[model samples]
Target: MTIQRLEVSNPEFTPNNTQMVTVHSSHLKRRHDINFYNVNASGQNLPVIILLHGVYGNSWVWMNLGGIDKAYEKVKAELNIPEFILAMPSDGGRLDGSAYLPSLNAGNYEKWIVEDVIDACKQTLDSVTHNSHFYISGLSMGGYGALRLGAKYPNLFNGISAHSAITKLADMAHFVETPLSEYQCEHSSEADVMYWLKKNHHQLPKIRFDCGQDDVLYESNLQFEKQLKDAQIPYLFEQFSGGHEWAYWHLHVQKTVKFFADIEQSL
Candidate 1:
Protein backbone atom coordinates (compact mmCIF):
# COMPACT_ATOMS: atom_id res chain seq x y z
CA MET A 1 0.00 0.00 0.00
CA THR A 2 1.23 3.45 -0.92
CA ILE A 3 0.87 6.46 1.34
CA GLN A 4 -1.55 8.95 -0.17
CA ARG A 5 -0.40 12.23 1.31
CA LEU A 6 -2.88 14.89 2.35
CA GLU A 7 -2.83 18.43 3.76
CA VAL A 8 -5.46 19.16 6.37
CA SER A 9 -6.06 21.69 9.15
CA ASN A 10 -7.19 21.77 12.75
CA PRO A 11 -7.97 25.43 13.50
CA GLU A 12 -8.18 24.63 17.20
CA PHE A 13 -4.46 23.94 17.23
CA THR A 14 -1.63 25.56 15.25
CA PRO A 15 -2.87 26.55 11.84
CA ASN A 16 0.57 26.36 10.28
CA ASN A 17 1.41 22.83 11.48
CA THR A 18 1.51 20.81 8.26
CA GLN A 19 -0.62 17.68 8.42
CA MET A 20 2.19 15.42 7.20
CA VAL A 21 0.38 12.52 5.57
CA THR A 22 0.09 8.79 4.60
CA VAL A 23 -2.38 5.87 4.50
CA HIS A 24 -2.42 2.17 5.56
CA SER A 25 -3.27 -0.73 3.19
CA SER A 26 -6.52 -1.88 4.78
CA HIS A 27 -7.73 1.68 4.66
CA LEU A 28 -6.75 2.11 1.05
CA LYS A 29 -8.66 -0.95 -0.12
CA ARG A 30 -11.86 -0.05 1.69
CA ARG A 31 -11.23 3.63 1.20
CA HIS A 32 -10.71 3.75 4.95
CA ASP A 33 -8.92 6.99 5.87
CA ILE A 34 -6.21 7.41 8.55
CA ASN A 35 -3.81 10.31 9.09
CA PHE A 36 -0.16 10.17 10.12
CA TYR A 37 2.54 12.68 11.06
CA ASN A 38 5.91 11.31 9.97
CA VAL A 39 9.28 12.64 11.17
CA ASN A 40 12.43 11.54 9.41
CA ALA A 41 15.68 11.49 11.40
CA SER A 42 19.20 12.19 10.12
CA GLY A 43 20.23 8.59 9.56
CA GLN A 44 19.62 6.43 6.51
CA ASN A 45 18.41 3.43 8.52
CA LEU A 46 16.25 3.87 11.65
CA PRO A 47 13.56 2.24 13.68
CA VAL A 48 9.94 3.42 13.54
CA ILE A 49 7.47 4.06 16.30
CA ILE A 50 3.73 4.08 15.63
CA LEU A 51 1.55 6.03 18.06
CA LEU A 52 -2.13 5.18 18.53
CA HIS A 53 -4.65 7.58 20.08
CA GLY A 54 -7.31 6.86 22.69
CA VAL A 55 -11.09 6.57 22.68
CA TYR A 56 -12.92 9.69 21.61
CA GLY A 57 -9.53 10.99 20.57
CA ASN A 58 -7.88 11.31 17.18
CA SER A 59 -4.38 11.83 15.79
CA TRP A 60 -4.84 15.55 16.50
CA VAL A 61 -5.11 15.04 20.29
CA TRP A 62 -1.52 13.80 20.55
CA MET A 63 -0.35 16.79 18.53
CA ASN A 64 -2.30 19.20 20.76
CA LEU A 65 -0.38 18.03 23.82
CA GLY A 66 2.82 18.18 21.76
CA GLY A 67 3.38 14.52 22.55
CA ILE A 68 3.90 13.20 18.99
CA ASP A 69 6.32 15.86 17.84
CA LYS A 70 7.99 15.83 21.26
CA ALA A 71 8.72 12.12 20.85
CA TYR A 72 10.45 12.86 17.57
CA GLU A 73 12.39 15.76 19.07
CA LYS A 74 13.52 13.87 22.19
CA VAL A 75 14.72 10.79 20.31
CA LYS A 76 16.50 12.86 17.71
CA ALA A 77 18.10 14.97 20.47
CA GLU A 78 19.33 11.91 22.35
CA LEU A 79 21.41 11.01 19.28
CA ASN A 80 22.05 7.56 20.77
CA ILE A 81 18.62 6.63 19.52
CA PRO A 82 18.37 5.69 15.89
CA GLU A 83 16.46 7.83 13.44
CA PHE A 84 12.75 7.10 13.93
CA ILE A 85 9.40 7.62 12.27
CA LEU A 86 6.29 8.45 14.29
CA ALA A 87 2.93 7.57 12.71
CA MET A 88 -0.16 8.55 14.69
CA PRO A 89 -3.40 7.31 13.16
CA SER A 90 -6.89 8.58 13.81
CA ASP A 91 -8.63 5.21 14.23
CA GLY A 92 -11.79 6.31 12.46
CA GLY A 93 -15.20 5.71 14.07
CA ARG A 94 -13.45 3.42 16.51
CA LEU A 95 -12.88 6.41 18.78
CA ASP A 96 -16.52 6.70 19.70
CA GLY A 97 -15.80 4.87 22.96
CA SER A 98 -15.05 1.65 21.04
CA ALA A 99 -11.69 0.91 22.74
CA TYR A 100 -10.27 -0.11 19.34
CA LEU A 101 -12.18 -3.34 19.48
CA PRO A 102 -13.79 -4.82 16.37
CA SER A 103 -17.10 -3.11 16.78
CA LEU A 104 -20.30 -4.11 15.06
CA ASN A 105 -20.05 -0.62 13.69
CA ALA A 106 -16.25 -0.38 13.18
CA GLY A 107 -15.34 -3.95 12.18
CA ASN A 108 -12.05 -5.39 13.52
CA TYR A 109 -9.98 -2.64 15.13
CA GLU A 110 -7.01 -4.92 15.70
CA LYS A 111 -6.93 -6.08 12.09
CA TRP A 112 -7.08 -2.53 10.79
CA ILE A 113 -4.14 -1.64 13.02
CA VAL A 114 -1.82 -4.64 12.59
CA GLU A 115 -2.63 -5.58 9.01
CA ASP A 116 -3.63 -2.36 7.28
CA VAL A 117 -2.19 0.67 9.07
CA ILE A 118 1.07 -0.98 10.08
CA ASP A 119 1.66 -2.77 6.80
CA ALA A 120 1.15 0.47 4.95
CA CYS A 121 3.55 2.27 7.24
CA LYS A 122 6.17 -0.42 6.79
CA GLN A 123 5.86 -0.79 3.04
CA THR A 124 5.15 2.82 2.12
CA LEU A 125 7.51 4.30 4.73
CA ASP A 126 10.32 1.83 3.91
CA SER A 127 9.98 0.10 7.31
CA VAL A 128 12.51 -2.67 6.78
CA THR A 129 15.70 -0.78 7.46
CA HIS A 130 19.15 -2.23 7.93
CA ASN A 131 19.46 -1.21 11.60
CA SER A 132 15.99 -0.65 12.95
CA HIS A 133 12.77 -2.30 14.13
CA PHE A 134 9.14 -1.22 14.65
CA TYR A 135 7.50 -0.10 17.89
CA ILE A 136 4.18 1.29 19.20
CA SER A 137 2.46 2.95 22.20
CA GLY A 138 -0.74 4.71 23.20
CA LEU A 139 -2.78 6.33 26.01
CA SER A 140 -5.99 5.27 27.76
CA MET A 141 -8.14 3.42 25.25
CA GLY A 142 -5.33 3.76 22.80
CA GLY A 143 -3.10 2.25 25.44
CA TYR A 144 -5.39 -0.74 25.52
CA GLY A 145 -5.35 -0.68 21.75
CA ALA A 146 -1.55 -0.63 21.63
CA LEU A 147 -1.23 -3.58 23.99
CA ARG A 148 -3.94 -5.53 22.30
CA LEU A 149 -2.57 -4.86 18.85
CA GLY A 150 1.00 -5.60 19.87
CA ALA A 151 -0.12 -8.74 21.58
CA LYS A 152 -2.06 -9.74 18.50
CA TYR A 153 0.83 -9.10 16.15
CA PRO A 154 3.98 -9.59 18.19
CA ASN A 155 6.50 -9.54 15.34
CA LEU A 156 5.24 -6.21 14.06
CA PHE A 157 6.26 -4.14 17.10
CA ASN A 158 9.48 -4.51 19.08
CA GLY A 159 8.09 -2.75 22.19
CA ILE A 160 4.98 -0.97 23.42
CA SER A 161 3.67 1.38 26.11
CA ALA A 162 0.16 1.80 27.50
CA HIS A 163 -0.37 5.00 29.48
CA SER A 164 -3.44 5.53 31.63
CA ALA A 165 -4.90 2.42 29.99
CA ILE A 166 -8.28 1.09 30.94
CA THR A 167 -6.68 -2.28 31.55
CA LYS A 168 -9.77 -4.45 31.83
CA LEU A 169 -12.54 -3.73 29.36
CA ALA A 170 -14.83 -6.16 31.19
CA ASP A 171 -14.32 -4.19 34.37
CA MET A 172 -15.13 -0.96 32.57
CA ALA A 173 -18.38 -2.55 31.44
CA HIS A 174 -19.60 -2.65 35.02
CA PHE A 175 -18.99 1.05 35.48
CA VAL A 176 -20.65 1.86 32.17
CA GLU A 177 -23.73 -0.13 33.12
CA THR A 178 -24.75 2.97 34.98
CA PRO A 179 -23.37 5.91 33.00
CA LEU A 180 -20.17 7.81 32.25
CA SER A 181 -19.53 10.80 30.07
CA GLU A 182 -16.53 9.61 28.03
CA TYR A 183 -17.42 5.99 27.35
CA GLN A 184 -20.23 3.60 26.67
CA CYS A 185 -17.98 0.93 28.15
CA GLU A 186 -20.82 -1.56 28.32
CA HIS A 187 -20.43 -2.31 24.61
CA SER A 188 -17.10 -4.07 25.16
CA SER A 189 -16.60 -7.34 27.01
CA GLU A 190 -13.74 -8.45 29.24
CA ALA A 191 -14.17 -11.97 27.96
CA ASP A 192 -13.35 -10.78 24.48
CA VAL A 193 -10.16 -9.15 25.64
CA MET A 194 -9.25 -12.29 27.55
CA TYR A 195 -9.88 -14.35 24.44
CA TRP A 196 -7.51 -12.11 22.57
CA LEU A 197 -4.86 -12.59 25.24
CA LYS A 198 -5.32 -16.33 25.28
CA LYS A 199 -4.87 -16.55 21.55
CA ASN A 200 -1.90 -14.21 21.29
CA HIS A 201 -0.22 -13.91 24.70
CA HIS A 202 2.70 -16.05 23.57
CA GLN A 203 3.41 -13.55 20.82
CA LEU A 204 2.94 -10.53 23.05
CA PRO A 205 5.41 -7.66 22.59
CA LYS A 206 7.51 -6.21 25.42
CA ILE A 207 5.08 -3.77 27.02
CA ARG A 208 4.99 -0.92 29.55
CA PHE A 209 1.92 0.31 31.40
CA ASP A 210 1.29 3.21 33.77
CA CYS A 211 -1.68 5.07 35.17
CA GLY A 212 -2.38 8.18 37.19
CA GLN A 213 -2.55 7.44 40.92
CA ASP A 214 -5.73 9.49 41.22
CA ASP A 215 -7.45 8.21 38.11
CA VAL A 216 -10.61 6.14 38.32
CA LEU A 217 -9.20 3.55 35.92
CA TYR A 218 -6.20 2.89 38.14
CA GLU A 219 -7.74 -0.23 39.62
CA SER A 220 -8.32 -1.78 36.24
CA ASN A 221 -4.78 -1.00 35.20
CA LEU A 222 -3.52 -2.69 38.34
CA GLN A 223 -5.68 -5.72 37.70
CA PHE A 224 -4.34 -6.18 34.18
CA GLU A 225 -0.82 -5.58 35.40
CA LYS A 226 -1.36 -8.40 37.86
CA GLN A 227 -2.51 -10.64 35.09
CA LEU A 228 0.64 -9.88 33.14
CA LYS A 229 2.75 -10.58 36.21
CA ASP A 230 0.93 -13.79 36.99
CA ALA A 231 1.54 -14.94 33.44
CA GLN A 232 5.20 -13.93 33.66
CA ILE A 233 4.69 -11.47 30.86
CA PRO A 234 7.71 -9.19 30.42
CA TYR A 235 6.50 -5.64 31.03
CA LEU A 236 7.15 -2.41 32.90
CA PHE A 237 4.47 -1.23 35.28
CA GLU A 238 4.38 2.05 37.17
CA GLN A 239 2.12 4.59 38.90
CA PHE A 240 2.62 8.33 38.88
CA SER A 241 0.94 11.30 40.54
CA GLY A 242 -1.75 12.76 38.27
CA GLY A 243 -5.28 12.22 37.04
CA HIS A 244 -7.15 11.08 33.89
CA GLU A 245 -6.46 14.27 31.99
CA TRP A 246 -4.01 15.09 29.19
CA ALA A 247 -1.42 16.43 31.63
CA TYR A 248 -0.55 12.96 32.86
CA TRP A 249 -0.58 11.41 29.41
CA HIS A 250 1.51 14.20 27.93
CA LEU A 251 4.23 13.62 30.51
CA HIS A 252 3.91 9.87 30.18
CA VAL A 253 4.64 10.07 26.46
CA GLN A 254 8.26 11.01 27.14
CA LYS A 255 8.76 8.06 29.44
CA THR A 256 7.11 5.82 26.88
CA VAL A 257 9.39 6.99 24.07
CA LYS A 258 12.42 6.60 26.31
CA PHE A 259 11.32 3.09 27.16
CA PHE A 260 11.03 2.20 23.48
CA ALA A 261 14.37 3.83 22.76
CA ASP A 262 15.98 1.69 25.43
CA ILE A 263 14.43 -1.42 24.01
CA GLU A 264 15.57 -0.51 20.53
CA GLN A 265 19.14 -0.01 21.76
CA SER A 266 19.22 -3.41 23.45
CA LEU A 267 18.22 -5.12 20.22
Candidate 2:
Protein backbone atom coordinates (compact mmCIF):
# COMPACT_ATOMS: atom_id res chain seq x y z
CA MET A 1 0.00 0.00 0.00
CA THR A 2 1.28 3.48 -0.92
CA ILE A 3 1.77 5.49 2.26
CA GLN A 4 0.02 8.73 1.46
CA ARG A 5 1.09 12.00 2.99
CA LEU A 6 -0.17 12.18 6.60
CA GLU A 7 -2.71 14.83 7.58
CA VAL A 8 -2.59 16.00 11.18
CA SER A 9 -5.24 18.30 12.60
CA ASN A 10 -4.44 21.37 14.64
CA PRO A 11 -4.14 20.71 18.33
CA GLU A 12 -7.34 21.16 20.35
CA PHE A 13 -6.99 22.30 23.93
CA THR A 14 -9.12 20.69 26.62
CA PRO A 15 -10.60 22.24 29.76
CA ASN A 16 -7.56 20.90 31.56
CA ASN A 17 -4.50 23.15 31.42
CA THR A 18 -2.11 20.27 30.74
CA GLN A 19 -3.41 18.73 27.52
CA MET A 20 -4.38 19.06 23.86
CA VAL A 21 -5.90 16.66 21.31
CA THR A 22 -4.90 16.05 17.70
CA VAL A 23 -6.76 13.97 15.13
CA HIS A 24 -4.88 12.84 12.05
CA SER A 25 -5.73 11.24 8.74
CA SER A 26 -3.57 8.22 8.05
CA HIS A 27 -2.70 7.05 4.56
CA LEU A 28 -0.81 3.97 5.63
CA LYS A 29 -3.76 1.59 5.79
CA ARG A 30 -7.50 1.55 5.19
CA ARG A 31 -8.36 2.82 8.70
CA HIS A 32 -7.11 6.33 8.10
CA ASP A 33 -8.59 7.75 11.31
CA ILE A 34 -6.28 8.23 14.27
CA ASN A 35 -6.30 10.65 17.20
CA PHE A 36 -4.29 11.41 20.37
CA TYR A 37 -4.29 13.67 23.43
CA ASN A 38 -0.93 15.07 24.49
CA VAL A 39 0.34 16.47 27.73
CA ASN A 40 3.10 18.88 26.71
CA ALA A 41 6.00 18.88 29.15
CA SER A 42 7.23 22.24 27.91
CA GLY A 43 10.61 21.52 26.27
CA GLN A 44 12.08 20.70 22.93
CA ASN A 45 12.88 17.15 21.83
CA LEU A 46 10.95 15.68 24.75
CA PRO A 47 10.39 11.95 25.09
CA VAL A 48 7.43 11.03 22.88
CA ILE A 49 5.66 8.43 24.99
CA ILE A 50 2.87 7.05 22.85
CA LEU A 51 -0.04 5.62 24.89
CA LEU A 52 -2.49 3.19 23.30
CA HIS A 53 -5.94 2.90 24.88
CA GLY A 54 -7.88 -0.36 25.39
CA VAL A 55 -11.00 -1.46 23.49
CA TYR A 56 -13.97 0.94 23.36
CA GLY A 57 -11.61 3.73 24.31
CA ASN A 58 -10.35 6.83 22.55
CA SER A 59 -7.57 9.41 22.91
CA TRP A 60 -9.24 11.22 25.81
CA VAL A 61 -9.43 8.20 28.09
CA TRP A 62 -6.35 9.18 30.08
CA MET A 63 -7.24 12.80 30.34
CA ASN A 64 -10.80 12.01 31.37
CA LEU A 65 -10.00 9.41 34.00
CA GLY A 66 -6.64 10.25 35.62
CA GLY A 67 -5.93 13.72 34.26
CA ILE A 68 -2.40 13.98 32.83
CA ASP A 69 -1.84 17.25 34.64
CA LYS A 70 -2.62 15.60 37.92
CA ALA A 71 -0.37 12.66 37.21
CA TYR A 72 2.51 14.95 36.25
CA GLU A 73 2.02 16.96 39.40
CA LYS A 74 2.15 13.87 41.61
CA VAL A 75 5.06 12.23 39.83
CA LYS A 76 7.17 15.38 39.75
CA ALA A 77 6.43 16.44 43.31
CA GLU A 78 6.99 13.00 44.75
CA LEU A 79 9.21 11.08 42.33
CA ASN A 80 11.05 14.02 40.71
CA ILE A 81 10.42 12.43 37.35
CA PRO A 82 11.57 14.29 34.26
CA GLU A 83 9.01 16.00 32.08
CA PHE A 84 7.84 14.18 28.93
CA ILE A 85 5.15 14.57 26.28
CA LEU A 86 2.31 12.01 26.51
CA ALA A 87 0.72 10.87 23.24
CA MET A 88 -2.49 8.88 23.87
CA PRO A 89 -3.83 7.64 20.55
CA SER A 90 -7.01 5.78 19.63
CA ASP A 91 -6.19 2.40 18.00
CA GLY A 92 -9.36 2.92 15.92
CA GLY A 93 -10.00 -0.47 14.40
CA ARG A 94 -12.26 -3.44 15.25
CA LEU A 95 -14.61 -2.77 18.17
CA ASP A 96 -12.49 -5.09 20.26
CA GLY A 97 -9.47 -2.89 19.45
CA SER A 98 -7.08 -3.59 16.59
CA ALA A 99 -4.73 -5.22 19.08
CA TYR A 100 -2.43 -2.67 17.49
CA LEU A 101 -1.48 -5.30 14.95
CA PRO A 102 -2.07 -5.58 11.25
CA SER A 103 -4.95 -7.98 10.59
CA LEU A 104 -6.31 -9.85 7.59
CA ASN A 105 -9.31 -7.53 7.64
CA ALA A 106 -7.73 -4.49 9.28
CA GLY A 107 -4.95 -3.48 6.91
CA ASN A 108 -1.57 -2.53 8.37
CA TYR A 109 -2.63 -1.22 11.80
CA GLU A 110 0.82 -2.15 13.08
CA LYS A 111 2.47 0.23 10.63
CA TRP A 112 -0.22 2.72 11.55
CA ILE A 113 1.07 2.67 15.12
CA VAL A 114 4.79 1.98 14.60
CA GLU A 115 5.12 4.43 11.73
CA ASP A 116 2.23 6.72 10.78
CA VAL A 117 1.24 7.74 14.30
CA ILE A 118 4.77 8.91 15.05
CA ASP A 119 4.91 10.74 11.74
CA ALA A 120 1.66 12.49 12.59
CA CYS A 121 3.00 13.56 15.97
CA LYS A 122 6.21 14.95 14.47
CA GLN A 123 4.20 17.02 12.04
CA THR A 124 1.69 18.31 14.61
CA LEU A 125 3.94 19.04 17.59
CA ASP A 126 6.54 21.75 17.00
CA SER A 127 8.60 20.73 20.02
CA VAL A 128 8.72 17.16 18.66
CA THR A 129 11.31 16.54 15.92
CA HIS A 130 12.73 13.52 14.16
CA ASN A 131 15.29 13.00 16.88
CA SER A 132 12.82 13.25 19.77
CA HIS A 133 12.85 10.19 22.05
CA PHE A 134 10.08 7.57 22.09
CA TYR A 135 8.37 5.27 24.65
CA ILE A 136 5.20 3.11 24.88
CA SER A 137 2.54 2.15 27.48
CA GLY A 138 -1.11 1.19 27.62
CA LEU A 139 -3.95 -0.48 29.53
CA SER A 140 -5.28 -3.99 28.74
CA MET A 141 -5.25 -4.39 24.96
CA GLY A 142 -3.25 -1.21 24.81
CA GLY A 143 -0.76 -2.84 27.15
CA TYR A 144 -0.55 -5.82 24.82
CA GLY A 145 0.15 -3.43 21.95
CA ALA A 146 2.80 -1.59 23.88
CA LEU A 147 4.70 -4.77 24.68
CA ARG A 148 4.23 -6.30 21.26
CA LEU A 149 5.53 -3.22 19.46
CA GLY A 150 8.26 -2.51 21.98
CA ALA A 151 9.45 -6.10 21.65
CA LYS A 152 9.26 -6.09 17.86
CA TYR A 153 11.05 -2.76 17.39
CA PRO A 154 13.21 -2.50 20.46
CA ASN A 155 15.48 0.01 18.81
CA LEU A 156 12.66 2.54 18.56
CA PHE A 157 11.70 2.59 22.23
CA ASN A 158 13.51 3.50 25.45
CA GLY A 159 11.08 1.61 27.71
CA ILE A 160 7.71 -0.14 27.88
CA SER A 161 4.90 -0.50 30.47
CA ALA A 162 1.33 -1.74 30.67
CA HIS A 163 -1.40 -2.04 33.32
CA SER A 164 -3.65 -5.13 33.51
CA ALA A 165 -2.79 -5.99 29.89
CA ILE A 166 -3.81 -9.00 27.86
CA THR A 167 -0.55 -10.90 27.40
CA LYS A 168 -1.69 -13.95 25.39
CA LEU A 169 -3.85 -14.03 22.28
CA ALA A 170 -6.03 -16.77 23.78
CA ASP A 171 -7.08 -14.29 26.45
CA MET A 172 -9.00 -12.18 23.95
CA ALA A 173 -11.63 -14.77 23.00
CA HIS A 174 -13.93 -13.49 25.71
CA PHE A 175 -13.87 -9.97 24.32
CA VAL A 176 -13.20 -10.06 20.58
CA GLU A 177 -14.78 -11.87 17.67
CA THR A 178 -11.52 -12.66 15.92
CA PRO A 179 -10.32 -16.13 16.80
CA LEU A 180 -6.69 -16.85 17.71
CA SER A 181 -6.24 -19.00 14.63
CA GLU A 182 -7.32 -16.17 12.32
CA TYR A 183 -5.30 -13.64 14.29
CA GLN A 184 -2.21 -15.76 13.63
CA CYS A 185 -2.57 -15.71 9.87
CA GLU A 186 0.58 -14.47 8.16
CA HIS A 187 -1.36 -11.82 6.28
CA SER A 188 -2.76 -10.46 9.55
CA SER A 189 0.44 -10.44 11.56
CA GLU A 190 3.49 -8.31 11.09
CA ALA A 191 4.99 -8.63 14.58
CA ASP A 192 2.87 -10.90 16.70
CA VAL A 193 4.51 -10.98 20.14
CA MET A 194 4.57 -14.78 20.00
CA TYR A 195 7.32 -14.68 17.37
CA TRP A 196 8.80 -11.20 17.70
CA LEU A 197 10.34 -11.68 21.15
CA LYS A 198 12.55 -14.54 19.97
CA LYS A 199 14.30 -12.27 17.51
CA ASN A 200 14.38 -9.12 19.67
CA HIS A 201 14.40 -10.33 23.30
CA HIS A 202 18.03 -9.42 23.83
CA GLN A 203 17.31 -5.88 22.73
CA LEU A 204 13.89 -5.41 24.31
CA PRO A 205 13.85 -2.11 26.19
CA LYS A 206 13.39 -1.78 29.97
CA ILE A 207 10.12 -3.57 30.57
CA ARG A 208 7.42 -3.36 33.27
CA PHE A 209 3.87 -4.72 33.59
CA ASP A 210 1.38 -5.14 36.41
CA CYS A 211 -2.17 -6.42 36.83
CA GLY A 212 -4.71 -5.93 39.60
CA GLN A 213 -5.32 -8.63 42.22
CA ASP A 214 -9.03 -8.80 41.51
CA ASP A 215 -8.65 -8.64 37.77
CA VAL A 216 -9.36 -11.57 35.44
CA LEU A 217 -6.14 -11.01 33.50
CA TYR A 218 -3.98 -11.35 36.59
CA GLU A 219 -3.20 -15.05 36.15
CA SER A 220 -2.17 -14.67 32.53
CA ASN A 221 0.02 -11.78 33.55
CA LEU A 222 1.71 -14.08 36.04
CA GLN A 223 2.21 -16.67 33.33
CA PHE A 224 3.65 -13.92 31.11
CA GLU A 225 5.93 -12.87 33.96
CA LYS A 226 7.19 -16.45 34.13
CA GLN A 227 7.77 -16.46 30.40
CA LEU A 228 10.01 -13.46 30.79
CA LYS A 229 11.68 -14.83 33.90
CA ASP A 230 12.42 -18.22 32.32
CA ALA A 231 13.91 -16.38 29.40
CA GLN A 232 16.17 -14.54 31.86
CA ILE A 233 14.45 -11.26 31.14
CA PRO A 234 14.49 -8.61 33.84
CA TYR A 235 11.40 -6.51 34.60
CA LEU A 236 9.41 -4.72 37.28
CA PHE A 237 6.23 -6.60 38.09
CA GLU A 238 3.72 -5.99 40.86
CA GLN A 239 0.14 -6.72 41.87
CA PHE A 240 -2.10 -4.37 43.78
CA SER A 241 -5.65 -4.41 45.23
CA GLY A 242 -7.87 -3.53 42.33
CA GLY A 243 -9.37 -4.83 39.08
CA HIS A 244 -9.21 -4.22 35.34
CA GLU A 245 -10.73 -0.78 35.48
CA TRP A 246 -9.74 2.84 35.00
CA ALA A 247 -9.12 3.17 38.73
CA TYR A 248 -6.38 0.56 38.54
CA TRP A 249 -4.71 2.06 35.49
CA HIS A 250 -4.96 5.63 36.73
CA LEU A 251 -3.35 4.74 40.02
CA HIS A 252 -0.35 3.03 38.41
CA VAL A 253 0.07 5.08 35.25
CA GLN A 254 2.40 7.45 37.09
CA LYS A 255 4.77 4.59 37.79
CA THR A 256 4.98 3.99 34.08
CA VAL A 257 6.07 7.57 33.54
CA LYS A 258 8.56 7.39 36.40
CA PHE A 259 9.95 4.18 34.95
CA PHE A 260 10.35 5.71 31.51
CA ALA A 261 11.88 8.83 33.04
CA ASP A 262 14.58 6.69 34.63
CA ILE A 263 15.37 4.95 31.36
CA GLU A 264 15.48 8.25 29.47
CA GLN A 265 17.85 9.87 31.98
CA SER A 266 20.05 6.78 32.21
CA LEU A 267 20.75 6.95 28.51
Scored by lDDT, the top model is 2
Candidate 2: stretches off by over 4 Å: 1-40, 177-184, 187-194
Error of 1 at 188 (Å): 10
Candidate 1 C-alpha lDDT tens digits along 1-267? 333443333535623322333343343234344445543234545676777776667666787665667655766586666556776776655335456655443355556677666555545444435355778788877777787777766777789888887666654453344233233333444224445566777777678889998988888888887787777777789999998888788777888778887887888
Per-model lDDT: 0.65, 0.74
TM-score of 1: 0.77
Q: Residue 139, candidate 1: how far off, in angstroms?
A: 0.6
Whole-model lDDT for model 1 versus the true structure? 0.65
lDDT of 2 by residue, 2-78 (tens): 33554545436334334343333343334344444444456788778888888777776777775654775788789
